[model samples]
Target: MNQSSSQSSNRSLPDSEYYRAFLDRDSNYDGIFFAGVRSTGIFCRPTCSARKPKLENCEFFATAQDALLAGYRPCKRCHPTDHPGSTSPLIKELITLVESDLTRRWKDQDLRARGIDPTTARRQFKSRFGMTFVAYARARRMGEGLKTIRSGERVIDAQIDSGYESGSGFRDAFSKMMGSPPSGNVAHTLKAEWIDTPLGPMIALADESALHLLEFVDRPGLETEILRLRQKHGLAILPGRTPITELLESELASYFRGQLQEFTTPLHLYGSDFQKSVLKILQQIPYGETWTYAQQSEALGNPKAIRAVARANGMNQIPILIPCHRVIGSDGKLTGYSGGLARKEWLLDLEKRRKS
Candidate 1:
C-alpha cells in the first residue's frame, strides 16, 4: 500500500479549507485535523470552544502526534487528545458532579436545582453512556452501597449511605441491578469504568485481577453485551474501578500517546474455546500491521474457516488490546469494526504513524 497516499488522505483538504473550518468551529472537521496555535503553543480540535488563534498563528496537522512533534502541547480546555466529537462539556461536568458525590441520590429536581436541564442531561448521558444521567447516578450510588456492605457495614447503614431511606427500597434497587439481593458474603463482583481515548469513550468491565470486557461506549448492543456478561458470570456489575481497570486505563493512556505498543494488562477471555483461540491469534498480530481474515483463519490452522474467523472477530469484546481492528478484507479495504469504520481507520493511522 502507498503510505504516502494514506497520509495525504488524512490531510487532503488544503490549509485554507482547514482554517475556514477552524474559524467556524465545524464539528465535521473535528478529528480531520488539529489546529496548533503558534502563539499559545497548544493544539486543539476544530470544534474547540477556546478563543481561536489568528490565522497567521495557526498551523494544522493530521494527528495529535504531529502537533506534539511540532512542539505544541495539547489544549487543556478542549482536550484535543481525546476522541473528537465524542464527549460534550455537559457530559464531563455531570460526570465530575457524580464523582464528587457518589452517594448522592440525583433526582430530576436535583439536576434542575443545579441549573442543569433534566431533559438535556438525560439526552446527553443516554447518547454518551447508553443510559440516562439518573440511571448512571443510581448505579454509582448502588456501587458505593455495595462497597460499604462488602466492608462489613450493616445493611441498614449501607442503605442510608446510598441515600435510600427505606430498606425495602434499597433491596429492590439492589436486586434489580444485581439479579439478586445483596449479601455481605457475596464474593464476586465486576466493576465497570469509562475510559476516554482518542478514538472514543470505551467502557471497561473487570474484576480485581483481570479485565473481562472493553468496548467503545457507542458500540451497538453494548448494553446487551453488559447484560450478557452479568448473566453469564452471575456477578453484579457496578459502576466502580478495580485494580485491573486502573491498569488498563493507564495502559490506554500510554497507548494513545504512542509510548506503548504491547498491552500487558491481564485479561479474562469469556468465549468458547474456538473463539478464545481466534482472539489469541488477534493479539499475536504485530503492532502497526494488517492481516486478512483468511490469514487469521490459516493462522488458526483452519484455512477454510475464514467466515468463521470473521464471525469470531465480530464477537470480540476487547478491541485495541485484542487488535481486531488489524484485520482487514482480502481486497485490502477495511471491514466491519464494532467501534465504527472511522475509528478503525483512525486507529490504523495512529499505529502506522507511530511505527514510522
Candidate 2:
C-alpha cells in the first residue's frame, strides 16, 4: 500500500540484479521493477523486447506509476502497466469448477458452497471477464453443448448432455440460438471460440469461410445476433477450432496488446448493401482516429443519411475489426457503442496511447 519507494525501505532487490534481469529478459522481474530509459523517455517491463539502454540511462522504479511520475511514457511495446497473470486465486478456483462441469448451472449459491462471497465473486469476475460469473458459466456450458452436438449426438441427447431438464425448453433455446433444430449434418456447424483480452472476454463466431461475429461476451443482444446469424446462414453454433477462429485468436491477441493496428481476417458479414458499405467505410477510419456520423454519411455520398449511417453502425455484428466505435457524434462526443461507452473510451484511449 506504500505509494513511493522512498516511503518503503528495502523495496526492491539490488539495482545491479534488476539490470541483469532486464538484460536476460527474465519475466520473474516483471512487476518487481520497471525500467525507465532516459535515452528513449519510455518505461518498460524488465522483460521488454526493446533493446536495453545503457546502465547509466536506465533508472529502476518500483512501479509503473513511479516511472510515469518521473516523466517517462509507457513503452508501447511492453505495456508495463498490465499484468495478465495477476488473476485472483479465488477466480482461478471458480474457473476450474466451471471447466470441470460444463453441464452444471453455476449460481451464487454455488460460490457460497465453495466459501466464496457472491458479491466479491461477481465483482471480480465482471472485472476480468466483463460479465457475471453466472454468464461465464452459461457461455462455458453452451460451448460444451455445441461441441457435444457437433459430435453426432442427437439433438435431444445433446440437450440432456448439456444439462437441460425439459426437452421443450431445450428445443426452444436451441432454435433461438441455432435458428434451426440440431441437425445431423456436421458440416453445418459454425465455430464459437472465446478469446480473452485485457478489455474483456470476446466471443468469436467463424466457419471455414470467414469470421461472422466478433463481439464482447457481455454485449447486449449477443444471443439475438447469434440466432440471426444461424437463421441467415443456416448453420448451428458449436464450440471448436476453425482456421478462421485460430487466426482471429492470434490477431485479436496482437490487436489488444497494441502490436497490431489493422485486422486482416476475412469476414462473412451479412447485411443489406448499405450496411456493408457503411461497415467497409468504418474499416477505413484509420487506426488512431475517429469520425463523426455526418462525416461517414458524407463519405458514402449521402450526406443526408446521418441517422442511417448511425443505424448501420449499430447493426454491425463485428465490432472491433470493423471499428464502429470510431464513429462519434457530430458534436465530437462519443455516442452509443454496443460494448458500452466506457469500453469505447478505453479503445480510443488505447489507440491514442499506442500512437503516442
Best by TM-score: 2
- Write model 1 residue lDDT over 125-206, tens digit each, in one string: 6765356777666544443333322323444555665455663554444444344433555456776565646554466778
How high a TM-score does candidate 1 get? Answer: 0.54
Q: Best candidate per lDDT, number?
A: 1
Worst 10 residues of 2 by lDDT: 1-10
Q: What is the per-residue lDDT of model 2 for residues 173-194, given as tens digits with 9 covering 90 to 100?
A: 4444554544775347776665
- Deviation from native of the Cα of residue 285 in model 2, angstroms: 0.5
Q: What lDDT would each prediction earn against the true structure?
A: 0.72, 0.70
Among residues 3 or more apart in sequence or in different chains, the pairs in candidate 2 whose N, CA or C atoms overlap within 3 Å are: none
Worst 10 residues of 1 by lDDT: 1-10
Candidate 2: where is the Cα deviation over 4 Å?
1-176, 179-188
Q: How well does candidate 2 score on lDDT at residue 81?
A: 46
Off by over 4 Å in 1: 1-181, 184-187
User: What TM-score do all the candidates reach, one by one?
Assistant: 0.54, 0.56
